[model samples]
Target chain A: MDQIMSNLGLLFEFPIVNLKIILDGVMIGSLFALAAYGLALVWGVMNVKNLAQGDFVIAGGYVSWFLVKTEWLQSLLGVSDNFVILLGVLVAFVVMGAIGWVCYKLIITKVIERDLFTSLLATFGLAIMMAQIMNLLFGSDTQSLKLEYDTLYFADGLIDLPIAKLIGVCMAAGLALAVVLFMKTSRMGQAIRATAQDSRAARVLGIDTEKVYAFTFSLNAAICGAAGAIIVMVWVIQPFYGITYSVRAFVIVTAAGLGNLPGVIAAGLGIGAAEQYGSHIFGIGYQQAIAVLLLLIILIYKLLRQRRLRQVLQ
Target chain B: MKLKFATLALAGVAVAALSSTASAADCDEIHLGSAISLTGKYATNGVHAKNGYEFAIKKIAENGGVKIGDKCYNFRVSYYDDESKGDRGATLAERLINQDGVQYMLGPYSSGLTKAIAPVTEKYQIPMVEAEGASRSLFNKGYKYLFAVLSTSEQYLASAITLAAEMATANGKDPSSVKVAVAVENDPFSLDIRAGVLEDAGKQGMKIVIDEKLPRDLSDMTAILTKVKLLKPDVLIVSGHSKGAATAVRQIGEQKISVPMVAITHCEAADVTGNFGEFAENILCSTQWAETLTYEDPIFGSAANYEKEFKAAYSEYASKKVPYQTAQASAAVYVFKDAFERAGSLDKEKVRDAIAATNLSTFYGDIKFSDSGNNIAKPMVLRQIQGGEYNVVAPSKFASHKLVWPRK
Candidate 1:
């Protein structure tokens, strides 16, 4: 009857949409991964989730927005508009690094080895406090940076990249690569990585593991701040949206698994794109629902797989 | 020594009795139970409502509380935080009614929470004074005990269509080709608004290009923004979480989408808190009060004063530098006190009937309950944030300035 054909119609229609969904998922997933890599860096090193990671990004973005609109950077440094972005990224890096250093030296350092729960609670508390402070300092409002890069147009309208998004993607990629290079090559980065794997072993090998941990946490925060600056080029930054970004980061790290930077970056882009495509298919109402569903499925799948292996052993 | 001790004991007894009579003669201390959301998402709305009540209580006490033929009663209030949750709100309402034995109660910040606690109020026969609630079903349930100070979501969203039609003509946009994309919150108030918007769309010849009811936590709106961009609609009307609306605004900006935005309900309030000064321009929204009200407004002239005093007293309680809930709360206090005074007693039925007869002006507005115990037709004002202030811009008469349309 109509039910069978309508059900059959979906069977025919789902493949075309399935491909589109996957394609869309990959695009948004990558972006989620990128944002998550920032959090993962902090988590893997200092064991702090960086609750204010998204806000730091948002604040950096507002700074960049001010730089672009008021051309204050041009006035201050006599830099061209082309150099404003580079200046913004550098500025965000230093500012966020300093903030991280202060936050750690004063607050986070005292509670580092207390317990996992303490760190989690402290960071989450810091996140809310920082959000309110941001509201007080800058107010609860949307701020963004406008760029002049032209949109990337493709045939068949399969992919149309916004100029700002293209720039954000490139900046995020470049920063993420720089982070990878530092982790791989730099002496401090090596010490941090060593400490992440084993703090006792790192200390035995003549590394000041405490310093490395603190620096790593700061570096992670700085990277997230830079990401915030970059993201505002493509997305809106709000004071209260730190929680959403944190959730997005959590989903990415969990979905892609830990320590996978490229996968993390891919997850961010994939999430952005999935939301876009999912909204198109299901009407934007179920966008968050889809992400929640994906996260739940993956989490449950992992749990079930582990259970099955346990059963086999028994 | 025994005779003197007896005389002194008698004197002490007389002093104790005299103090009791003196305390009774004041007859001014009236206890009110208030259950409001003091934290979480509903904190801002609850704090404001609480402030409105506080301001009214202060105003009344200064005017000798309330006069009931001869006796005047001063007000004292007790409150609990609902945390913006339905179960918690109902639990608090029960405690306020059963435990505290308050004759009247104010609050239940949202429709979900209000509806959850409505039965408790009915069971207790406590005349509940409602403000900032938007669910119409609360009134339609035939609960004579329930009363509201404002119109519900149905009337709120119906204004949107009328606004669109009126705005298009005034702004030099073609009314014939006006397209509205309704992106309302998935909440009950928003759902009702979405329905009303769709219902009125055909009448105004308003084409609904995108009718979307999104959840409050939609952080990734790229697809929705991209679709709305592709549709190239002239006007985008979003009705949802205030923070969500603010995010939509920033997303629209990032995409270089230059369409005028209209938000309904609490989203407008969120727009104020989320957008702040620089980015608050040109986004039209409907609200109960405009911060930039004239001297005639009961609360507007004193808003700055209230802000200063409230911050001094309840600094740890509230943060945002805006007013709405305070007016609702303070005025409710005044109304409750005035009505109780008119009724001449603290009896629940008499107070309910007196509250029903509230027709005069107060600190918030001229509030009067209809036969059904809701505001007869309390108006919703359309305001836009300009230079960090919410300016009234619609109904022409209440407008502080002419409409600022999108340049494109």
Candidate 2:
């Protein structure tokens, strides 16, 4: 009885505390939602899927980190890590935009009239090449930028949030709102929507559809860069990090469906929260299993739903 | 046109025929081959491993290498990047052995990659001086030529447990009374380390609150952080993560979990996370190499100066750090270089004997490769990340500070 009682103490003594975890998840997940917006944008505006969006974000993070560490941008403007990150955002968008434009002009345009499979393969090749170039240039060590943010003890009980995440959360919300406004009202945004809805009709209206694709890609790259800059304040950067983050973004993109911002945000938040809960219920040992399980569940559901529809049609 | 083509073809044939005959002269130089990763997912580990061997290669060449009594022969290396894949690693290993005729080898970044290349090493009968791969089974596989210079996961994790207890006690806490959760990255190495922790933690009467395996490349560890905070584990052990452990520490600090955390296998890269600033303090980790010892030792000071000159010359090439890889790599090459000199011959049997007889002080500590080529003397030390620098804290002989465990 004594031994059993002690073993029970191991099981229940440390109940999964919720507040700190949920808040941290939401705060971090918001950035995921923000970065996911970039992926959704390029896929929506340009019919070309960008497999290198996460690498673009990683590039952005590195740019800001380098600028702050090396004082490279000191002469142009006096700025802290925030300013550097903002600059990184600008640089990521511009550089990736140029790279995307060059990529399209060189390879994608050749496959534009071909099947979708050709374009997908081309984009994948681009992702791999970009990853290699990153390895070559950055040399694969995990690097992070520091932020001077205080930890806020809002309540005595449990919710202790890092001020950095609080800032990042607010910035992500602001960025997401900006993306919404741009898509709704901006002229280029309207051109992108027109091309997305009907590419021929947009060109007939003098939308310059190729320019729209390039601009949209640039915009997508810029948003990813912004996310990267924010992440540097909150997370760490490794060379292959883009591959992992890219997959995570793709998950939200698929779950949320095409051009649905709210759905994306919900999916990101839900995943972040669920991973937290998973750690609680299953122990930290199985947190990653949650994502794999979710992927499997969705896969099974889709298969079953399709089978049911096929039977009905039959 | 036919006559002109025949004349040009004759000249090309002469060039090739001459070059082929000249290849025989290459036999005078002994080439050490390695199938090290310099690209792909685990690119960082590969690149660092390459640097370790390079430092040795440079030293060997500078000293006119392999003084087999009367003859001082030039030693060289033919390296190819395996990109951290087993198939690629094995192919490279075979190419290095069969095609290039490399006799001695140092390699193969991880255990999985090492295991992949093990059969190739055996087939070639090349004596492999391996460092990096800590899979016990890699050595246990009854391969006579394969020798390792570091601790396996079981040995390394035992050290972590001992240090954890000592650290808690040093901080004036009841080391025996605690809820310790074993959180590890879900890989062979991580599983080995954390499983060891659970076994030891269970025996020590520390409640095993959580034991979970995570992905090797998880970008977001906020959820894991939140869970650990909720569990309020006195210690959270995230071992064998190539990249995620730093983020775990940052997230834990952001949430102010205030638990004394121990990150296994990745305390080496903590210096790069200046973004976490002072928040990264008191985060402890274990590794095979010691950086400051090189800075502090007089013998290493000369080597350090040599490294400084090299770094100054090669700053444009790569990131600058007294990397953990450099310590192991430089040691690997020096071990071979010293052995060849001591053996008085470049013969395989003699060099093998010399390697087994090696008992010398290295950057980490005193190192002596067992007859099996495993470093029996090198002990894994526990260190803490303070202001982005990993300061040794566990062993009293080398520790810079008494271990401090933070409590909320």
Candidate 3:
């Protein structure tokens, strides 16, 4: 008990270390929120649960990797190396958008009106297929985009910060805001909201609900693709890493509740900060476990709340 | 016409049967099975191991096979893809032993997969010779049927720490004053390496500032690096595999967390230098084998000759150098060949006994397993990346180049 108290005391003694941890967490949290927003968009608008959300993100990262490897943007278009990442982001969005549309037409369309369990299983299978296909095509290697950026240290080098991560977070925030604006003003955006409210009523009112659903799914893929491109520029990516991203998205969406944009952003950052602190306090091996534990706690809380509400109504 | 056709069919059947028996009569062919990680996370090293095993078989066959008593036996390998999963590897290992009637087996790539397959081999009482899976916990399990070719995981980073102590002593600083920080993956292999480093640090009386466990996927290292910058340890050691090495190299550069020396493992196996280029330079890495070593073999002439042959055979799939995993895998084949010839019989128990008493040198290095089934005689080589090439820098006798102190 004394040892535990000392360990806790050590964590509190260093305010600078805690600050750095929170900064790192918030930056990573923004990326999670960006991906989770995409997941929530599809879930709310189309009611199709996508287990392959992370795979789309990874696929987006790979698209950027492929472009960088070929030097296609630099050689063919004469773009500079610094600008290659931006072009890669655009390409990822379009490529994943097309893939998402095709997925909706083939697999998602059949299971759209069926039970949620059927959609879950179908997407789960889709996720496995995407992971394996990626392995076959890309050859199971961990790859990252190389950026020639300098480190920005503050507090006499006590707090080390990477310029690349700052750039990635900025890009993620900009894309997310653009998505929010599109949903607020565009005709397709209103159609999606209407469909989410009532699909039958929206269809009767001359809104092509099917087209809205497909577009919503594609837009979500685009959002995830852009998020993946930024992630690759910031960190490393592998073929089998899709599931972690999916789980983070699922956790964020469930905690924030459907269609609650502010809550989603807050929950995402909260999870990220909590993860950093959790790993630091309780060894790094339990980092992933913390995310799962947070998910369990939230579910239990929701179950208890529902039980209490039922008793009050009776 | 129908009677004539029937007679022709009967004659064809008789000829086929005679050919089959004639082929079976040649008892000079020895079959070995392997459930290798041909795909998934271990694919990169798995491909290397596969090529090395296949090349060794070809080399031995070219020399007219191994002579056993009055007969000669040629080696052939039958491989199944383990998919880099522990459970799948175990299932494939059992199928190789039972369904394929294989008497000997080669273990899979990673320690986790190897751990799963080791029980299956032991249960069936088949002697399994493996090149990968270096976790010390593996040997401590007391499985008689398992023999590993690579040095144990504990020795992987121990030499790197020893070199740092030597450097500190030469600089007129107290060796005990050398502070080290270690971040390792939370796996059996990484934990074994962590235990080794801690033990060596205690021996040298060095202080360990921060000893933390890295997550398996290596998703984040920023928090750890932030702490590392503030503490400023004399040496930092990182070990996991390719991904862990990649994360360390990348985050270290991004954070500019400069230390006096950094030694990492799995750099050459994962092609870390090839991927990161200048960022990987000046960073020391503990290696299983170096091509510059003066080890000689009857099959491939010298260590350099073996690498030349390997590159020539698989020229299209060129990296800067052949991974040490491939060489170790090939060396496992040599152990079996030597054991088969010494045993002078096809009996499993006799061959196992001969393997236990074996001592041979190959292009990889000397092979002499201790009572615990680890290659205790083999020493881990310390390598530094100089201008994107791996240079041997340790074990004084085998040092190919001088150490670049205070790595830039």
User: Which prediction has the highest lDDT against the true structure?
Assistant: 3
Alpha-carbon deviation at A163 in model 2, angstroms: 2.8
**Cα distance off (Å), candidate 1, residue B352:** 1.8
Q: Which stretches of candidate 3 lie over 4 Å from their true place?
A: A1-13, A295-314, B1-47, B57-127, B317-320, B340-351
Question: Candidate 2 on A1-314: residue-level lDDT in tens?
Answer: 35335333433654434555577668767877877888887777666666777777787677666667777676567666567765565565566556656766777667655677887788778778877787777766667765666777765535676666777788778878987898899997788889888888988888898788777766777777778877876777776778766766777787787789899999888777776666556655556577667767767887898899999999
Listed per model in order, the count of residue pairs whose N, CA or C atoms clash below 3 Å is: 45, 6, 0
Please tell me which predicted candidate would have the highest TM-score against the true structure: 3
Candidate 1 chain A, run of 10 with poorest lDDT: A2-11
Which structure is stronger by DockQ: 2 or 3?
3
lDDT of each: 0.68, 0.70, 0.86
lDDT of 1 by residue, A124-200 (tens): 88888888877766665455554556555443332455666655666766777888998899998888788888888
Sort by lDDT, best first: what order? 3, 2, 1
Candidate 1, which CAPRI tier? incorrect
DockQ, candidate 2, vs. native dimer: 0.29
Candidate order, TM-score descending = 3, 2, 1
- Residue B177 of model 2 has an lDDT of 76
By DockQ: ranked, best first: 3, 2, 1
Docking class of 3: acceptable
The per-residue C-alpha lDDT of model 3 at residue B91 equals 95
> lDDT tens digits, residues B17-48, model 2?
87555433332576788888887767877876
